[model samples]
Target: MNERMTKQPKAIQAIIFDLDGVLTDTAWYHYRAWKALADELAVPFTEQDNEQLKGVDRLNSLRWIAQKGGLALSTAEEARLMAQKNAHYLELIQHMSPADLYPGVQPLFAAIKAKGWKIGLASASKNAAFVLDRLGIAGDFNYVADANQVQNSKPDPEVFLLAASGLGVAPAHCIGVEDAVAGIEAICAAGMRPVGIGEPARLVQASLVVPQIAALSIAQLQALA
Candidate 1:
C-alpha cells in the first residue's frame, strides 16, 4: 500500500470511474501491449512492473520501459514505440464487446441512477471513450475525461477535476473509484471520496475499499456517502 486510510466527507451527487480496471479488465490488454513493446526494446517487463504503468500515460509508460532497459532513445524513436504500442492495444481491444464489462458495473450504474446521482469517467487512458463505445456503454456516462482531455496525468487530479466539473458537481459531492495507487491518490487530491476496487493492502489510500466491483452495493455506497 502506498498510503494509509484517510478521512472523507459525505454525500455523492456523482460517481466518477477509472476506465481500464474499474469498468473492465482492459488492464490486461494494456499489459500485453506494453510487454510486447518491451520485448522488442529488450526491456525486462513483468506483471509486477505492469502494475506501475496502470493509470499512466502512454509516453510515460514507454519512458519507464526504456529506463528499465537502460536505453535512451531520440524523440522520433519514442514516438514510434508509442504508436506501435497503441496499435497493438487497439488491435487487442477490437475483440471487446458489451460482455467485456466487469460484473456489477451496470447494476451499480443502475443503482446510482436510481438514486438520482450522475455518472462520469475519469480515466488516464486516451482510448477511454473508444473502449466505452466498444463495450456499448458510451451513452451511459454523463461525462468522460481522459488523457487526451487533460494536460496532466494520474496523481495530478486534473482528469478527476475535469470529470467533476463536467458533471456539474462539487468535488466533495462525488465519489471516485479506481484500482491503481496513483488513481486513488488522484481521487483524494480531487477532494472526492475514494473507493478502491482492489485489495486493501494495495489501495490503502481509499477510505472505502472492496475486493471487486461486484462487491459494491447501493447500501454500502449509501453508508459511505
Candidate 2:
C-alpha cells in the first residue's frame, strides 16, 4: 500500500462516490455487456474500446458502439440497444447482494455517517439504482445522481456538480471518491477534492489515491477537507 498524508481539517459536510469500479467490482460487468452487444451487431470491440468508454454513461456507450459498427442508429434505435445492454447487466448482477459489497465498504460508510457527513452516490451508470440495490447499500446514501440526470458525463464535471447540488452542499465542501481517471477529472473540474480508489499510478489527477477504501480512514479523509 502507498502512504501519503494531507493535513487534517474540519469535518466534511458530504461525500460523493462513483459506483462501478470504486464501490463494486462491476467494471468487468460493463465491459462484458458492451462486448456482448458488439458481438450481436457483428461489430469488433476490444478491451481498449471498453477502456475508452470508462466513466461514460450508458447512452454514450451505445453511441460509441453505433459509431464503431458504422451503423447509423436513430435515437429510438440507440435507446433500444442501451436497454438491451442494461437488461443483460441486470441479469448478470441478479445474484449480487450485500455479500458482494467490497471489503471495508460497510464499515467505512458507517464510520462516515457517524461523523455526520451526508453521503451521495454519483455514478455514470444509468443503472445506478440497480447496482446500488444489488449491493444493498441504497439506504446509505442521501442522494443518488445517475446518468439519467446529467447532460454530460465524467471529464465534463456535470455529474459531480449535479450530485453536490442535489445534496445541497457546495462543491468545495464535498469530497468525491472515484476509481477512473475521467472520474478524477470530473471531481476536480467540479471544484471538489478527489480520493481515488485504485492503483495510484492509474489515478494521476486525484488529490489522494489509495489502493481501495480499505486503506482509507475517516480521519485520513477528513484531512483532505
Model 2: lDDT of residue 47: 85
RMSD in angstroms between candidate 2 and the native structure over all alpha carbons: 5.0
In angstroms, the error of model 1 at 132 is 0.4
Model 2 has an lDDT value of 0.87
- Cα RMSD (Å) per model? 5.1, 5.0
lDDT (Cα, tens digit) per residue for candidate 2, span 58-155: 87788888888889898888888888998898888888888777899989999989998999988888888988998889999999998888788888
Instruction: After superposing candidate 2 on the true structure, give the runs of residues whose Cα lies further than 4 Å from its correct spot.
Output: 1-11
How close to the true structure is residue 38 of candidate 1, measured as C-alpha lDDT? 92
Worst lDDT run of 10 residues, candidate 2, spans 1-10
lDDT of 1 by residue, 1-225 (tens): 334335454667998999888989987889999999999988889998998998889988988989889999999999998999999999999989999999999998999999999999998998888899999999999999999988899999999999999999999999899999999999999999899999999899998999989999888877777
Q: After superposition, how far is residue 21 of candidate 1 from its true place, in Å?
A: 0.9
> What are the TM-scores, per candidate, against the unseen true structure?
0.94, 0.89
